[model samples]
Target: RASLPSGFRHLPGHFDRPAQEALVAELRQVITEAPLFTPVMPRTGKPFSVRMSNCGPLGWVSDLRGYRYQPLHPVTGRPWPAMPAVLTALWTELAPDAPPPEACLINFYTGDARMGLHQDRDEDTFDAPVVSVSLGDSALFRIGGQKRNDPTLSVRLASGDVALLGGAARLAFHGIDRLYPGTSTLLRDGGRINLTLRRVTRAA
Candidate 1:
């Protein structure tokens, strides 16, 4: 169990083999029930690199205007699916200091798909840490300081790996550079699935 910096932590093989398989199955079911789609970027009106959807009380959405969380899916026009107990438990154990997460952003990435460096600033509360779990292929995670050109560190994240970003590093700029094809045996296709859990705001 290699720990991350004070504010960060990396749990290698965090989710056991069986647990990973079960999570994949649950995600597949959720996709079948809600489906995944590419969302447009704010202002530019361009589509995001990663195709994403959500399964929880709230879903993160981006549009020509900006990024925001909504109670309903823009495409399905229905409330997002409830968060799975497994995910909630993971969050509660990993980020006890953070508020209960209400949004689960599910991102599907192909070999070529890459996420640009950005901060998780849409949420109203910064008190909670962001919990990101990776499944399937391995990816190079580039993490940097709050500034754009600040020093950066790259870490290889594989299936069943969980990374936590919190405290001073909570607002760090991070992104995925690339995914190693056919690295993990869990995924049906040669790709990666990333689930990011966040506390959007204080409960009403």
Candidate 2:
């Protein structure tokens, strides 16, 4: 395995099986309040491969207008579900100096769903790190430098694992290339759930 880019931290099995199950239980309630909706490209209106929902004061959404943080759900027209406490705790533990996260993007991947390489530049503050948690099946996570064409390294992220992209790597181009199915039994339906905790705005 090649060395990960600077400012990248990977914590394998950060959550034990019991803890992972507890987190999933909390997510079930979140999904009920804010159902997963397909996000489309800005102008092309092409839908992303993964289904997404959010829980926080602000939620990341995509549509004809493009990616931005908003307080309401696109489909429900209601405020997004409250950010789970477990996630907040995770962020605080890993990013003690950063502001409390305002957005927790829930990405549910099934079948062949995958995310493309991209920078998480939508947030107002780059000082805060993005804490990503993986559940269910494992997946091949790729990370590159600030530029899209920068050399990349692939990591196999499994259930209960956590990755923190902070400091220099906060704007790094990264995404999931593919998933290894049947790698875990965390999700009842046999897919993957990724929780990305991000601070959308600068602290007061």
Candidate 3:
């Protein structure tokens, strides 16, 4: 946990082999209901390197219109599948004090795909923490301060590892630098899958 910064916690191997397998099975089902779609950047409409999908009441989406949360898939126009019980249980176990998450953004990275430094700020509020669980391969996860240019730290997140962004680090700048293609055997085809659970709307 050297230089991990405050409020940003990384729990490596938080899910064990069997739990990870179960979650992967559930993710396969989620993909069937809401197949992955390529997301584009705002205005420029530049396609992201990763394919994305979601579960829960709302799903995060990006395009020429920018990032936002909606109940349905941007392409299929069908409501996202309900948040699987396993994910909900994880959230409850890790952050019992916070309200339950309403959106689970599923990202699938292949080849040399990587995400740039960014903050998760589109949500209505940051009262609840952003919980991310890594599966399939490993990624070099970067984290910086509230400012975009703040000094950063890098950590290798393996499958079943859980990372948390909450409290002071709720809006911290973080992203995936790259993936170690064969680091883990969780996915049959080889790649990395990430499940990021968040509270999209403010609690009543």
Q: Total clashing residue pairs per candidate?
A: 1, 0, 0
**Models sorted by lDDT, best on top:** 2, 3, 1
Query: What is the lDDT of every predicted structure here?
Result: 0.88, 0.94, 0.92
Clashes of 1: 1
**Pairs in clash, predicted candidate 2:** none
Q: Write the per-residue lDDT of candidate 1 for residues 1-204, one digit (tens) a residue.
A: 133335777888999999999999999888876788888888888888799989888899998878999998888898888888899999999977666889999999996999999888998888888899999999999888777787788899999999988887798888999999989989877799999999998756
TM of each candidate vs. truth: 0.95, 0.98, 0.97
What TM-score does model 2 achieve against the real structure?
0.98
Residue-wise C-alpha lDDT for candidate 2, range 107-187, written one tens digit per residue: 999989999999999989899889999999999999988888989999999999999998888988999999999999988
Using lDDT as the measure, the top candidate is 2
The regions of model 1 sitting more than 4 angstroms off are: 1-5
Residue pairs with colliding backbones in model 3 are none
